[model samples]
Target: MAGRLLLIWRLLVRDLRRHRTETLLLLLAITAATATLTLGLTLHELVARPYEQTRAATAGPDLVVQAGQPGPHSLDALAPLTTLPGVTNHSGPYPLAFLALTAGDTTARVVVEGRDGTPAAVDRPAVTDGTWIRPGGVVVERTFADALGVHVGDTVSVAGHPLGVTGFAVTAARPAYPRAGWHLPGSILTEGGGLVWVERGDIATLAGEQPLSYTVNLRLADPQAGAAVIDPSGGDARFRGWRFSTGQEIADTNGRLNAPAQQALMIGSWLLTALAVVGVAGIVAGRAIGQRRRVGLLKAVGAGPAMIAAVHLAEYLVIALAAAGTGLAVGWLAAPPLFRPTAGLLGSVGMHPPPLRMVAAATALALTIAVAATLAPVLRAAATDTTHALADAAVPPRRRRWVISLSRRLPIALLIGVRINARRPRRAWLVTVNTLITTTALAAALMALAQERSPVDLGYSKLPDARDERTTQAMILVVCVVCFLALLNTVVSTWTAVLSTRHPLAVTRVLGATPAQAGVGLAVAQLLPAIPGVAAGLLLGILTFFAGDDNQHAPASWMLTAGLGVPLAVVALTAIPAVAAARRPVADTLQAGVR
Candidate 1:
């Protein structure tokens, strides 16, 4: 038993050292998969935990009532809500007015709130920087301040009235900016703006009797029952164009601010995971074919099938373990950049370690992909007959009259490549799958980026929906990484193919096939499979993205271009490696072919 274990260990170490580049590529593929999965699985917890903490710290309101009327006493309409059932406490009838804020080169539409110098009982704004609203100063909302790059002591023109920035504050009375305005169900607001606070004494200076809306933050005994009690009529039956927001809804809004980005992360992660599996599988298959002689040698030395298989599998297991660790660390670091601090809280939230279940799941997936792809090839290689293994020979080709007849009609180089592919159809399929995964991810990303409307395009400088733009950016990131890795896989797979076909290619070269022709033949083999793969990937991308999207718009023509371009790019990428292999000394290759 000890001797068998020692042999396996020696084989494992030797193989790993001999194939350092292949091992590195394998690690990167697995790392990408696990890192993306970790981010996708834990996004909810990352976004929600900090929001809940912020909500608790700010004493966020249970219900927010917006009363709009064309009069100075518009707040009087909401006075009746103070007497409503389940309304345990109330904060305001604070003045709400819309105005333009100009800060240097930037101009933004802002909703200004009038508050007293004293803090409220229901919804308290947590001041992150500077001081609260002073007599002649304005407190900018955190998100708004961040967007405008304005800090304390800077003067901002609010409704054309210049005021010194006193501090940055965040409130739970509404979901941050852009969404600060009331959005009717199924009806997006034509315009959205951010929020700011000023002392009651300064309200008249900016508002000037422009018929402000009055908002009251209410604390309820049963916060969840807000919709039932607050909006009984479900229409303007309560107040003219009035809206009500429940506490739980506000919490959800804050927590799901990055819903679009999180969605992209999840979708991209799954696609990348599938690609990772294909890449590792291809590498394993290629490695197994290349190492047939090694397998035969082990068998001749009296090593059992179990010991040979263990040696091959152990190499991947170590790489898988290392990949998982690298991925976890990357995911942890990557998550922080996705979530930026908003006005509601002063400090950035520290990244809490993901739950044990998430780490376990990610690690298990990485291992499964590594082990599963190689298992079949390992078993097959281990079971090889000693005679064939020692001779380093393939099984006799089945005689096909049609193949011989067809070869005469094709160019010599293409004929040679076609014959090679016919011998190893499974390898061709693996390459096809790799291109398919890459194209599909690229298509999805292009579609996502196209659908996203930037905040500036919508005529708002600082809206809460800015998170949606961030989501699109994340999708682009995923696309770039997936495509890059796919390119690397192409290079590696080509190199492996060259190694496998050296002797056959050399014979063709000796028989008068030019190096360029040999290179074209090799590239054609990859291209033949790519045609079907590209088409399938396009369809797959369309179905995946459209099925998940609420909008049913047809994909643009450019998307097709991007999808079809991937396979072409892969064919082109194989050229250098193929040419390099073709130009290798024919005499040496033919000599090496002999057992």
Candidate 2:
């Protein structure tokens, strides 16, 4: 048994080394799918990580309460909540001044909050750059600072009062920039802008007449009891006219911000995997044709069907494992940049190894695709009779009377193209499926671009939505990858067709067909399948992405472009290999076929 296993390993290694190009192609197909899958599966956890880190580092609050009305005495109403049961520690009803801020030529509405020189027991913002707030100096929230392109030494004006930028900080106490808190002197329905921190005295000095609201951050002994602490059913007057939020609610909101990106990646990964399956099946079919004689040779040496199957399976199993590892590493490294952490969170988005479950899931997917593709071809080859396998004769193409009758009336190139497709209907379908996936991805990308053109209303002003921006980016990325794999698949399928039909095409060339006619015939086979694929893909893409969204519509121009462009692209890709095969010396091809 040990000796047989050793022999199988040697055979697998030698076979892979001999077909290095095919081996690499298999690896590329599987790795592309697996890497995308890894990114999709792990992105949500990665996006939520910074918030958790910030919460732990800053001793973030369990509950935050904001006064509904702004006045100098608002703190008097909020002060007693710090003494409520389950409130272990608290940061007071700090004064909040709603004002417009200007830095350089850019201006935006901001919430300027007053803080002490020393850190508060709860909800202390962690300074990421420079120092904490000081006299005549103001700290900017990290995300807001990024938007303004300001740093520690720069100065920004608050309600027209210029203050030197003291430092940059991140906090779990509020949602990231562009949503720091609500704008004041209006209904809280208005969109909030950014956040800046200054000393208590500066707040009174800078806002002589601006309305002031108060907010208190509370750290509960039991974080989950936040709802009970602020229960309105108690009829406590202090709870009235105050907005309260729990830590869990805030974390959930932060996580929701990444929902668009996560959905795009998850959907894209499945599309890519489908394309990979079609491509791998073609590669396996082509390799099986070339390996028939090898199967016969193994059988002659007294190898059983099980051993022969094992030998073929081992080669792909090794490649699958390698591809899975490479994919996991690529996905893990690529995710942080693609996610592009918003200035809202505390920690820099850094590379962390994916968790063990993600690694396992990606590996399992790769192995499954490899095994599924290779099994049918391996089993068929093993079952071939020894005599027929040793002869290595081409399987005669089954002639259909209707196909023959129809082909006889067509032009020579069209006749040849139609017959080639009829001979291998399965290959034609694979080409169709490949084109379908590519066109669907292209159409989805166009739809996303169309939606981006519409303005997003934020109640206060129109601004680009961060979620929409990320979703658009993710779609673009997925389209690029799917197109590349589709391109590779096109080339591979065309070349495989050329090899399989070499004998018949050579005979036709010898019988008076021009080389150009033969090449065009080969390209026509691919083009025919692509037409239906393109049409179906466009319909599917529109239904999948554009349905139920009143703001989004399928642009006719975009649909027409994809419907016409994909088939042309397919013809162009197929022509390279087709022309090369047609130019091969007819005599040599005929001689090889006879052997």
Candidate 3:
């Protein structure tokens, strides 16, 4: 058994070294799929890490209670909760003043909270730059400050009063910037804005006649008991006009913001995996045709079918494993940036080893794509009779009276292209599927772009909703990758067709067909199947992504462009390889075919 294993290993190494380009193509196909799969599976965890760090560093409260309506007595209404059951520690019924803030040329609605000069026991904002809030100075939430381009020493007008920026800080008491506005009393539907802090003494003066809301941060004996602690059903009148949020709830909210990006990635990963299957299947099929003689030689030397199959599969299995590892590393390193922490959170998320489950899933996908694509072709090659394989005779092309009659009146290029496609119908279909996947992905990206109405209003300037921006980005990435893989598949299929038909094409050349005709025939073969593919792809893209959302349909002009453009691109991609193969010296090709 050990000797047999060694023999098989040697055979695999020699084969891989001999066919370096094919091996590299297989690796590229599987690695692309696995990397995208890894990103889809692990992005949520990656995005959550920074928020967790922020929560821990700030000693974030288990529950935050906010008054529903701003009034002088809001603090009194919230005071009773400080000593409530299960409360271990508490931070003030801090005064919250909703006001417009203007810094530089930007103006935004902000929730200005009044904080003591000293840090509280719970929900303390960690100063990242400069000092904490002082008597006439204000501190801006780190993300908010970054958005406003305000640093320490800059003055921001709050409700028409100018106060010098004292510091920039982050806190877990509120969801990150743009989301913090959700906590405002009586403003649950308000668009996300920013948060800032001022000395407690400055609140009354800055607010003037504006009613003030209050919030209390509580540390519960059981952090998870927050929901239970807050009376629901309005059974207690004291709980009326108030809202309660648990730390877990806050974390979930922040995490939910990444759902769009995650959805795009997950969907794109599957699309890419499908393309990998199609691309690898074509490569394997072509390689099988080229390897018949080798299979015959092994059989003549007494190699059994199982040994033959194992030798073939081992090469791909090794490549697949290597691809999986490469993909996992790339996915891990790439994820943090795609689902990066919003500026609102403290600490940065860096690349870390993916979880075991994610690694397993990615590896499984790569191996599955390899096995599924290669198995049938390899098995067929293994089962061929030794004499037939050794002879390496090409199968005779099937003739039909209707096909001959139809081609008689057609142009030389179209006639040859039709016959060529008829000879290798399976490769033609793979090319079709390749075009379909690319078109579908491109259409989906266009739909995503068309659906955006406007950026979220962030006071001073509009910013794209993080979710929309990330989703669009993910879609664009998927489209680009799918297009790249499709282009590769086109080139491979066209070249393989060119090689398979060289003898017949050379005969046609001798019969007065020009090299350009032969080349255009090859391109035409790919384009014939692509017409239906592009149409199906447009329909699929619409059904999959725009079915329920009437507003998400891409403009008719864009759809028309994609429909016409893809086949043209297919023609362009196939032309290079087709022309190169067609222009090969006919005399040489014919002699090789005869030998």
Cα lDDT tens digits, model 2, 1-595, are 9999899889988988899988888889889989888777666666567788889899899999887788866767777788977888989789888777888877777888999998888898999899999989999998778767898899898878989998999888888767676565534654647889999889988887877788999998888887577673756675565677888877777777678788898899889888888888888888887888889998998988998899888998999999999888887778767866545766533445677888899899899888887888889988998889988888888899999999999999999899999998989999999999999999888877777454334333445566777777788888988988898888779877987889889989989999999999999988988888999999888777765546476589878988888898899998878988899999999888632
Per-residue lDDT value at 433 in model 1: 87
What are the root-mean-square deviations of the candidates from the true structure over C-alphas?
4.8, 2.6, 2.6
Report the Cα lDDT for candidate 3: 0.83
* Candidate 3 per-residue lDDT over residues 184-273, each given as its tens digit: 456656567888999999998988887788889999998878757767454787666567888887888777777878888888899999
- Report the lDDT tens digits of candidate 1 across residue range 350-423: 35666788779878988988887788888988888987887888566565788778876898767877787786
Let me know the TM-score candidate 1 reaches against the reference structure: 0.82
For each candidate in turn, the TM-score is: 0.82, 0.92, 0.92
Please identify which of the two predictions, 1 or 2, would achieve the higher lDDT against the true structure: 2
C-alpha lDDT of all candidate models, in order: 0.76, 0.83, 0.83
308 Cα displacement, candidate 3 (Å): 2.0
